[model samples]
Target: MNKVILIGRLTKDPELNFAAGSGTAVTRFSLAVTRPFKKDETDFINCIAFGKTGETIAQYLTKGRQLAVTGSIRTGSYDAKDGTKRYTTDVVVDSFEFIGSGNNGGAGRDQNSYNNGYGSSNTGSDYSNSSSNFGGMNFEEDMTPVDDGDMPF
Candidate 1:
């Protein structure tokens, strides 16, 4: 049950690199998420994406672009150059979605269901209004207006 979802703006451009020997793509970036209570306050969250997900994020996303990510929190400690143990915490991205339109910032597009295929599978469970047919079914097509008089609860 160690899952977290965040929707925020990119603080800066993502940094992409490959792991040694394995050559796995690794992208690191920060998200500026506004606090719920304080509209003026924001928290910069560190995020890391691996493999194809990392490459896609680094290539398509840019600074100030709104993004929604689903992942788990990871924490680690390392010896710093100043002879002190430094602790670090980051969100290990499992999947991501392009939120706002354009490279920088703008109004959100109708198709926010764009997934960057990190931990996705062909389970046929995805349902959306987007043009992309990842799942066979589009739940939007089967929707009907609910009447107040039909309430059973």
Candidate 2:
């Protein structure tokens, strides 16, 4: 029940780091989600992803690129250098997808034409491929059809 789903744009490039003791990869970023009914307001949410997901996000995602994420809310507190207690709320990203038409502020392209063989290397495009790449979730290909005869509703 502690789930959160959000579609938004990256406020900046994801910062990838490693755990001090375990050396596990961790990436942190902020998402700017627009308010549903407000035109000029946005919510800045902090998000974190671990392992290969974090590495992929840091490698492919950039600032201002639209993204969709499913995760859970997590809260933590730490003592600051100034002796003040600092609190943080973050979305521990379980899955994410790249949005837009691959033309994310012209950051998806390089001087060369090929974009790591993903898709068109045009700098004008924000995403390269047609499929929405996702992380942290394994999609099964052999899904059985549900029967409506056993419906409880």
Candidate 3:
């Protein structure tokens, strides 16, 4: 009964690595998730996914991409270099879904093709920065330029 679900955008591409001992694939990434009511705040969640899921994420997901994480919340502690004990909280992801992707490089990089994650931007400008519209917006025309002559000079 330690399940947790999160919808957010990847702050950056997941750093794929293999366990030194087990040689199992693992991905470490941070998700920028915002509160439902809060306007100027966001929580950066550190996540770790393993095995095929981690490989898939590493292959497909990228910075600012949306993703849905279904996993458990795990907290741990470590000793700092200053000889002080430090505590950390992390989500050991069991499974995840690639939500929407931004206009970087991909066939699915459209406005409506937003990944499943929620926008966690702390900037007060707009929430349209991510693949999904966390700002509660409807669909709009594709911002990517085509050969249209509608420029008003």
**Which candidate achieves the best lDDT against the true structure?**
1
List residue ranges in candidate 2 displaced over 4 A. 102-153
State TM-scores per candidate.
0.72, 0.68, 0.67
Off by more than 4 A, model 3: 105-153
Worst 10-residue stretch by lDDT in candidate 1?
144-153
Pitting candidate 1 against candidate 3, the one with the higher TM-score is: 1
- lDDT-sorted candidate list, best first: 1, 2, 3
Deviation in Å, model 3, residue 53 alpha carbon: 1.0
lDDT of 2 by residue, 1-153 (tens): 887877677788899999999999899999887667674677899999887667767887787666667778999999999999999999987666565523353355321121222222223313334333233332233222223232221
Per-model lDDT:
0.68, 0.64, 0.62
- Residue 141 Cα positional deviation in candidate 1, in Å, after optimal superposition: 18
Candidate 3 residue-pair clash tally:
7
> lDDT by residue for model 3 over 37-122, one digit each (tens)?
67456789999888766776787677777666767888989999999999988898765544444435433533322221322332
Candidate 2 is scored at a TM of 0.68
